[model samples]
Target: MTDTDIGYRATRRTVLPASLRLRYRLTPWWVKVIVVYLLARLASTVMLVALASVQGANPWTGAHPGYFDYASIWDGRWYDIVAEAGYPKSLPIGADGTVQQNAWAFLPAYPFLARAVMTVTFLPWSPAAVLVSFGFGLGAALVFYRLMALRLPGSTSLFATVIFCAGPTSPLFQLAYAESMYLFFLMLALYLLLKRRYWWMLAPVLVMAFTRPSGLAFALAMGFHVVYRWVVRRRDEFPVRERVASIVVMLVAGVSGIAWPAIAGLVTGVPDAYTATELSWRADYIGHVHLVPFAPWIQAADWWFGLFLQTSPWLGYITLVTVLALFGIWMFAPSVRRLGVDLRFWSVAYALYLLAVFFPQSSTFRLLAPMSPLAGAIAQPKSRTYRVVIVVLCLALQWGWLLVCWGVDGLDWSPP
Candidate 1:
């Protein structure tokens, strides 16, 4: 017991880790979000490289062969095209007399921003796309964490953010995909609504409408909230100006959601140009115009049921059972209630919208990214052990999903 032990203890107390802890204590919440997002991006990058390095995997290539090639596939390829060449003047008709897949089906917001960054900074398209996503994605994380903290304690909010970053499909945020950009706008719009800044929500709503198809979900939620306040609540509790602001938010959002497709149609001189191009990706590639209400659900049921039935009829039955189980979870889970009315309804409506319009393909996970707000339910549980277990399980599923969906040849069957 002596001078030697005292000297060792004294030296250890002034280590780099301890100093860094002191700095972290002084750091702001937004900076912590950036750090977490960057770390998550690093982890996802490692996973991507490992998956791509597997022997016999299809090269994610068209004009080039490398990581960027993988990043520029499926919807990403369309976005890259729009960024580089810009949209076409007319619909490219196929030999079968139906519309072919073209840039019109894709939205312009992310591509335009990426293009602008490329022009200003001289980065290549791939790097520019990544930069846009990484920057916007970090911003979205900041707002999302703030919103969560508003509803829950700081510790729980931070925990939920970690779980979200480590989610099975969150790798989309790391890629040069538009979901991250779309998420930034969505979160901003929601934050504006939360802060009671109805007017400020307009800009994000318009941008979000051009970013992804889910913009309407936000508009619907805003409109619903407005109606709920005026009709469901006491008349004396509302003000005329607030009601007018609410209506403006609703109308502006609703119009913004439809503006792009309508523009495509007007520019092309084909009323259904946008719808036709979108439907060109379906199972029946040249199906009719956009799906009517409930059609996507029917198509999804038929498609999944038939797919599973090929292996065994019982498997088809199991598919229905799985759906019923999910429905039960949606209806009964505490997470649903914990998200509050706006986010909960938005998640459910957005999920339904995706099911209706999008094929139940591999990229369905990415399409559902807007429902991230629902993940707030994860923060409701008080047990630290439970949160840890959930994060571990999510990461494990993420790795497995990467291996199964990405580590293979003929990768076109699944969208990235």
Candidate 2:
């Protein structure tokens, strides 16, 4: 990126009051990140509280539940169960003989971490789980800043961090969920991979694998990283040792990605324990369909098309193809390319992973949060108006997402 494209964090010319501007200029970058995170979380908490005030009694909470109670509902309660009762040895089977929803689907790392916190702090599951998310979210923001700084200017990277913190899903940071913790580990892993710190990457990569279903996507990224390096070896040196390390890491990542499933199957004495549990969540929407690789999107497309448009399902396929084509173009755009090849590789790999296995649903946004490095691309242009517009849209959409997904309508179909 050109110097003109990304100026210093604070310009000599500004509209701010002199004293406040001076204080802002003197503050540390990390401190600024903390302030942004805190302020963002505060805003999200406010939104959640407002929703909680009106929320009617549901399976998870009483009428007009408080902040922690509301946040602890949904997937947070699942994590709480995993932490308290642990996974079942025998899978719960429904009358139809399909696997019923159980603790096996939720990963162990985040909830166990919360359990540790609960032991020491004497806090209940709701508070402890939210604390885990809050703390790790701050960590994620800090690491995200450094990762963006690797390629963009410090100011631009910081702005990108701002975008991330204030993004629509910022509410996840305060909820009793694992997304914030997973993002911390995922971003740290990507940062290490980008720096070619092969050995160091193992820590976050393995941990994040258990934190979320990230192993396969990261392994795919490693594969692409290796090929990209080999293709450009004439300009960028790709040594034998580096290649060996990269290949080994890729294989390890693949193993880590599937490790949880293997463990679930073994312990439960059901060969498809993990996959079946995950599929059970969607059975309510798509019925008891068999799991097929790279087929979920096609099926989801038809399902969604038939549900909404009540017309030809082929239109859905064409729309999916068009979206993929546009996304591919965006991946190669000059602004995104500037973030480096590894970031792009991760984006593509994550996209492919989602396409192969995920059905289009309300949870898709949360799943896509791992590929958020592209925020740097948006924050690159040094236009105050543009930045303000982007941030404003983020804030507005924050409320929109809360209204549509977070708020519990009676028998709600949409979930965040």
Best by lDDT: 2
User: Model 1, range 181-214, lDDT digits (tens) per residue?
Assistant: 9888898888777676888888888888998876
Question: lDDT of model 1 at residue 400?
Answer: 76
Per-model CA lDDT versus the true structure: 0.75, 0.91
Off by over 4 Å in 2: 1-23
Off by over 4 Å in 1: 2-26, 55-65, 284-290, 311-332, 406-408
Worst 10 residues of 1 by lDDT: 55-64
What is the C-alpha lDDT profile of model 2 across 130-241, one tens digit per residue? 9999999999999999999999998899999989998988889889889999999999988998899888888888999998887999999999999999999999999999
